[model samples]
Target: MIRALALTLTLAPAGMAGAFELGFPVDCTLGETCFIQNYFDHDTGPGMQDFTCGPLTYDGHDGTDIRLPTTAWMEAGVAIHPVAPGRVKGLRDGMPDIAKDDPAAPALNGRDCGNGVVIDHGGGWETQYCHMKFGTVTVKAGDQVGRKTVLGKIGLSGNTVFPHLHLAVRKNGVEVDPFTPDAPTTCSAAPDPTTDLWEDPIPYDSFGFLDAGITDAAPDYAAVKAGLPPRLEFAPDTPALVIWAFFFGAKAGDVLTLRLKGPEETVVDQAVTIDRTQAQAMQFTGRKLRGSWPLGDYVGTLILTRDGVALEQRTLSATVK
Candidate 1:
């Protein structure tokens, strides 16, 4: 069951986070690409539900949020485009894209969507692009746009944390899930939508593995977000080594396993089972060693599985002097 309320948390996937890996609405760069920060909330009432009854969504969230990993990318400028051909119907721009903790963010009022663009595809198909960077919108209120037309750059405008494009789709003005185009979420009794816009929407077993790294210490967001990450190399005098892996979704009874192998064939293995369904990441810190250590290459491998089936696996490596 969804909690009575959604307390503000870090970024999250709104839906199942699936894709055909083709024809993205934004210029997708490796490590700089966007993930589904939120999927549309299919539960239009008291209980919460995504199309699959998954935890990847919140109550009332009505769009597929493609989110950037950091604010730096927002400033660097990422392009936003339309998935299908359409013409501009409405738009707004110029609101500052600030952090959720910023004091000036709350003043946006109904303009919280910040700089945005709207395109109306023919035949009951209309799309809304929200959180565009200021001064970057290339189209006007009544301009025509192609499937690949550059609408604007992604930004932190609107009610958002990281940089992203909240692509809200509608049919005749009522909200709809872009992922499941054929089946209306309101008809919960129907099967999952078979029609999809993506050419290949199947996600890999470990698709949720967003980022992984080895650190000199138990990592924090600041350290993880550091421009020069703590992985790849470490000094000989380093006190302790910590390994972390970030993933998207997990439910009770799912198992997460981690293993570390040293140059001399030393191995460290640890495992944890999720206690509930939620969006989160996990960390594992190796024992702090004092003596000068014999180190060359160290590897950390993570696998997430349930019911004897592997859902995902990831590996990280670091070197010491």
Candidate 2:
């Protein structure tokens, strides 16, 4: 059973002069069945068992299993919306989901970060929504969103034991406990010189930020259509490589294909079918491709299409040595 936070705490004063008021990512009603897992202290330690990924065993109690009521809604399309106004900063798409039994899976992984979006609310403060349904993200990098803007739907796409929004507020680029009383005080008292900034986003409900309203706009198909073919740029490193890709003109329910080719045109192909209803990123490791390649030159191409019609394509080259 998930523990619920008591509803009687005073809202933390918005930190940093110019810090934006953040919103809740879901339409959580008072007394509704919504709970935050791993809100603070996510890393493993005493009393902190990993809940994101599984092999979950806690004193003979399987931890991954959520103790649900006899009638629980485990349906897959809960909408994930922006909690505050911000600009889209980063996104990833075309990554594969980690296997349920993969022992190496983190409580969160690139794929479990399925179709994610990062929104920067200024002052170096950002919010990230992960494990979203494929292709449902309604915002893109560089686009601006208001408090009620729908971002995507919640799903178990990435490294998640259950469907829930993974949210955090960063100060100087590091995740800090928003609920900590001394967070704002500490951040306000002594500012970090290296980054020279501080941020604190009060978790929804913990304060009095409640569901105000929902914006019902037609799905942004133009933005969706613009993300069709995924584009990749690769830079080689001595033993490892850096690969980045941009996907555009894509929609929910579209199937995307990715291929990495080496000399002689040897191809390693992988495919990801997107749930266009959501706006998110798809990213993954080329572990299979890496296993087969010798340290040398390579090229990657990503193709997007639906119902046999070619949508878009992008290609890039890299060196592995």
Candidate 3:
């Protein structure tokens, strides 16, 4: 479902130089408000690898995916900007923002990019911004624009199940990885940034937490994907106490530990090992209330570890009233 639109675009030329310094395409800060959900696939065969030789991408992925934490953030609005100055080449708008799997979703019919914008940077260089919100496109075809121009807002249009900007770059009409113009023929050394496109360095993260919270019951995966509402106070008669986390860049064998500490004592301490790699994942652990939870505060901690070393830890607190 991803990048199916990009694969159909006609190529420019093969050997043109892709020398250009690009800026961050999304408005939010990386690793905090937004994250790189996918990178350009580097492997040539029927396999997948990112610039870092990591599993952050899928086979045939042609762009870097910058994703907001949830649909709620999409509703609040997050803008998408061009990486460089150019004339708006072409654009499409008015696509409904619906999940790919939703029963009412429209047929792709090569409209997979869904309400996106294309900018011509000259010299056979151009960029595409896809999956943008309906009615938020501020620029029109043939309009002059720059990095500061707000093209549109991130959305769940096209073949996406989540809100994100699927950004693809081309030189001479041929797809190229902005992080590294030439995809690695072999996954070996780390990516060399000197020849990359970004004006400032975007750190390569292997894994991190997207969101975490304390809830009164086991989290609903679909609701979590939509975005969990913040709640810090719970009734004493709550059915259970749960701590849940949403994360990305997971690898097989990674160990996740979820611990909940009540006012006077430690309540639940649980560890789970990931058996498969996932682009985004959710996990949770908690205890059901017997009569009523102790009237005090509870802290839930989530620690994700790899190779026996802790990689990231997030804590959420809740109070019983």
Q: Lowest-scoring 10 consecutive residues by lDDT in candidate 3?
A: 8-17
> Residue 265's C-alpha lDDT in candidate 1?
62
Against the true structure, candidate 2 has what lDDT?
Answer: 0.45
TM-score of 3: 0.93
lDDT per prediction? Answer: 0.66, 0.45, 0.86
Better of 2 and 3 by TM-score: 3
lDDT of 1 by residue, 1-321 (tens): 122233221122234223321256888753325567566666646565665656667776877777765556667788988877778999887777775556777576667577898888876667888888878988888898886799999987777655778887666655656556544344243334344445445231213665667776666664343222446887877877767776566767888887877787654687888787765455564667667545799889988887888877877888887
lDDT of 3 by residue, 198-255 (tens): 8898988889888889988888999998888998999988998888899998899999
Ranking by TM-score: 3, 1, 2
lDDT of 3 at 227: 89
Residue 100, model 1: lDDT of 56
Off by over 4 Å in 1: 1-23, 29-32, 101-104, 186-193, 197-207, 222-230, 265-267
Q: Where is the poorest 10-residue window by lDDT in model 1?
A: 1-10
- C-alpha positional error of residue 111 in candidate 3 after TM-score superposition, expressed in Å: 1.0
Best by lDDT: 3
Each candidate structure's TM-score, on Cα atoms with residue i matched to residue i, is: 0.81, 0.42, 0.93
Writing each residue's lDDT as its tens digit, candidate 2 over 174-284 gives 553343322321212222322212133322211110011111112232222222222232333233332333332245666667666667555456677766422223432
The residue pairs found clashing in candidate 3 are 12-172, 12-173, 13-172
